[model samples]
Target: MKTNFLAAAAASFVVAGASVASAQDADAPWEQSPFRCEPGETYVMNVMVSGVEYWFPVYEMFKQAAHQFGCEADYTGTPEYDVNKQIATFEQALAKQPAGILLHPMNPDPFVEPINRATEAGTAVVTFAADSPNSKRVSYVTSDNAREGRVAAQQVAEDMGGSGQYAVLENPGQDNHDRRVAAFIEEMEDNYPDMELVGRASTGQDPNKAYQAVLSLAQANPELGAVFMPEASSAMGAAQAAKEAGGDIRVMSVDVNASVLDMIQAGEMFGAINPNQGTQGYYGFLLLWLAKHPELIDPMNDHAEAGFNPMGIPVLDNGYSVVTQENAESFYWDKYLKKRGTRGIEG
Candidate 1:
C-alpha cells in the first residue's frame, strides 16, 4: 500500500511541474513565445510626445488601440517641451528596434531624416499633434488646424460685428499655432474685410506674457473688438486682461481648458474651439493599430497588391467643438472634474 501511494504522489508531482512550465512559457515576451513573430512578425510601438496636458489624451487613445491588437506600446517624452530632448527620446525609442513609432515632433525639419530612416528600415512611422510634413510617416492623426483657426476667427468676427482691431496671442513659431494664426488672418482678409488684425504678439505659451499683451492691446486700442488666443493657458490670461482693461473687447480662443469653460459660462469670454480629447486618444490608437495589423483593414486598389499598408493616406478629421454659453453645460467637464478632482477642460 505504501509503495502504491508513493508512485501516485510522484506522478502528480510530474503533472504539476509540466503545468508550471507551460504557464511560464505562455507568459514569455513576444520575442520568446511560440506566438511571437517567426522572423519579422512581432510588432512593438513607441509613442514619443512632450507633455501630458496638451497631447497625452491623444497618446492614451493610441495606447488603447495597441492593446486591442495584442501589441506593446511605450509612451515617453521630455517633461518641459525641449526640442533637443524630444529628438533624443525619439532616437532612444528607435534604438529598441520597435515595429512602429508615433511621434509629436518638436522641430518638424530636424525630425525629417530620423523619421525617414525609420520608414526606410521598414518601421511604420506616424505623426500626431505636431506633424513633420516632409517626413515619410504613414499618416497624421489630428484636427484640421486651419479650419479650427478660421472657425475661431469667424466666432470672433461675429461677436464683434465683423469690424474692430484684433490681436493674436500666439505660441511664437510652433507649427500648429503658426498655421492657426495664418488661417485666422486669411479668413479675416478674405471674408471680414472690415475687421483689422492690429497685432501678432508672441507670448511663448506663457500666461503672464499673454495677459500683458492683451492688456497693452486693450489699453492702446479701445476699438479692439476681439482678442484671439490660440492656446488655452493664454486664453485665460487674455480674458483676465480684457476684464482688467474694463472695455468692450471680446475674447475668442482655442482649446477647452477648465478655466476657459468657466470663463465661457460666466460670459467673460466668447467661446473656444474644443477638439475632443478622448477621441484623440481613441482614434490615434486605431491608426497605429491599423499600421501594425494591415490585414484587419481592407486594401486600397491604388496601392500595390503585395504591399501591406492598405490604409491609403486616410486623413481622420477628429473634428472640433465650439464651447459657447448655449451648450457649455453639456460639455464633459463636470464628470471629469468631480471624479478626478483635477482640472483640464474644467479649468
Candidate 2:
C-alpha cells in the first residue's frame, strides 16, 4: 500500500490525542479491565547499538506507550557495536524478568539463542528495525526497507537524467541495511541501465568512515552522480564531503536526525526516507504486551491455545516517506512533536 507521507508525519500527534481522549472516558480501551499489567511488571527496549539521535524519538514513543498502559519501560544497549556485548546486555535484562522486550538485533545469528531463552522463560520479545527471523521472537516491526531503496534509486536516477555513475555506503552484515542496498542495486540494474554503480563501501554506522569513504569514492570516480546509504549518520558525513568537493555528488539516505534534516534544508542532500519510528515503538510495546497477555485478545480468536503461543508471528510494515526540501522541516521529530502540541521525552 502507498503511504500517505503527510499523515504518517502527523501520526505521533494522533496517538497523543488518542491517549488524552482515552483518559476521560471510563470505558476507554486502555482502561478496560483485561489488559492491565500486573504490579511491578515492566518492559524494556534493547538495541545492539545505542547513542544515536535516531533512537531518541523511538524511546520517547516507547515511554509514551508504557505510560498509557500503566507500565514502565527502560532502554538498554551497548554503545560498542559488538553483538556479544549486546547479547550480554540482553541476558542481563532477561535476568530481571521483564514483562516483555523490544529488541533491535544487530545481526540475526547472534540473537537466536537469547531470543529463544527469553521466549522459553515467558518474556514476550518483539524486534524492531532489524529482525532475527529464525528466533522465537513474536513479531517484527519496521518500515519497508526494500521499498526505501527502490524509491531512493528511482529518485536519484531520475534526477540524474536516468544515466550517471553512483555509489553505495553500506552497513555490512546487518540484514535491514543489506536489504536496502541490494534492492537499490537491483532497481538500478533493472530500470536504469545507464546509472552504473561505480563503487561500494562499508561505513558501519560511522559518519567519519562515511566521510572518508565518500571522499575516496569521489576521488576515484570524479563523474559520480549520486551516493546512497541506509541510514543518516553516514549521510551527515557524506553530505559534508559532497559540499567540500564542489557539491556535484548528490547524497541520499534513509532515516533522519536534526543534522540530516538541516542538510536537506540547505540543499546538501537529495532526499531521505523516514520510517514511522513512533509507530515502531508504540505498537512494538502493544504487540509485546498482547503476546505476554494473550488472554486479553483471546476473545477475538476461537483457538484454544494457552500460555504465550505468540498470538501470531506477524511482520508489520510501519511505512515510510521520501523527505525533500519542500517538506523537510515537518519531518524533524522535535518540530513534529512541538507542532502537534505534545512534549518530547525531556518535556
Q: Which candidate should be chosen as best, given lDDT against the real structure?
A: 2
User: For model 2, what is the error of residue 145's alpha carbon versus the real structure, in angstroms, after optimal superposition?
Assistant: 0.7
Model 2 spans with C-alpha error above 4 angstroms: 1-32, 297-310, 337-347
* Clashing residue pairs, backbone N/CA/C < 3 A, model 2: none
Residue-by-residue lDDT tens digits, candidate 2, 61-113: 88887887688888988887788999999999999999999999999998999
* Cα error, candidate 1, residue 280 (Å): 2.5
Steric collisions counted per model: 7, 0
Candidate 2 global lDDT: 0.84
Measured by TM-score, the strongest candidate is 2
Off by over 4 Å in 1: 1-49, 294-314, 330-334, 337-347
How does candidate 1 fare on TM-score? 0.76
